[model samples]
Target: VKKIISILQAARSKTLQQWKELDCSITIVANEAKDNVRYLYTLDKYFGPLAHASPVMMEHIPSLMNTVFMIYCTSPYYNTSEHMTSLFLKITNQMINTCKTYLCEG
Candidate 1:
């Protein structure tokens, strides 16, 4: 969860930086936007701080990927790709049934 949060924060930061480079005050060439001023303020409010934290979040992807791979391997039959499709379906069904049983019992 922490890794995921970091990744999202980094992405938000990068997006903020790219947005900041634009001239928000420029008038639209094709259509005169009625809320151009409001839009500029909104853009500043949205992307300003997120740009700073982007790098820290991006640095965590490798560990996060490893964790996901580990979880995906939790299925006993995940070792081989030959039966991967069938194995995935079976695993999903088992998970669903387990959840249903637990729900009923609780």
Candidate 2:
């Protein structure tokens, strides 16, 4: 879990730096981040059901929930396009649902 968080944090920081250096629009940055997340989700073998069921991961549920809520609440500020806004909301909802499922079922 710590390694996952560290990797994600590093990716996020790199993304932000690249966004600034390239002077890309917020929508582009958001889309890139979303794509990266989608790619990560595809790696279910690394974070599948058994991983979620681990005691260490289960203990972090509250922290994960808080992070998800923060992301959902702050997404609008980063969304500049109508399509991106809708997509962001959809993704956020999915994340929240996943977190809820893990917390409740684990």
Candidate 3:
């Protein structure tokens, strides 16, 4: 899990670097690998900053949540893509609401 968080932090940094260089003209569609072992804390660490830097993060909120959900969904203990996607949306909506709250408060 520690290693997974480190990798995700790296990926998040890469995404920010790409966003800076590319100016987000292109959509970065990521692929899912089987048995992904990423950690949620790593994602949480990056989400706030990434969203702060890029307003478009709000647009792809579903994809972001899906990425995290898929990590858990791919586990051997419970392989559930449908439930993962559904939960992803639920979480995505909460994230969006949080973002909206922050935007309004600021």
In order, the Cα lDDT scores of the candidates are 0.43, 0.52, 0.53
Query: How do the residues 36-70 of candidate 2 rate in per-residue lDDT, one tens digit apiece?
Result: 47543433442343244345544554654454444
Report the candidate with higher TM-score, 2 versus 3.
Answer: 3
What's model 2's overall lDDT? 0.52
lDDT of 1: 0.43
| Most TM-score-accurate candidate | 3
Q: Which pairs clash (backbone N, Cα, C closer than 3 Å) in model 3? A: none
Residue range with the least summed lDDT across 10 consecutive positions in model 3: 26-35
- Say which prediction, candidate 2 or candidate 3, comes out ahead on lDDT: 3
After superposition of all CA atoms, the RMSD between model 3 and the true structure is 17.9
Flag the better candidate by lDDT, 1 or 3: 3
Model 1 lDDT tens row, 5-52: 456567776555334433332434213344333323332432322233
Off by over 4 Å in 2: 1-53, 77-106
Candidate 3, residue 38: lDDT: 37
Model 3, span 1-61: residue lDDT tens: 3454456567776455444544333322221232232344435654664446346656666
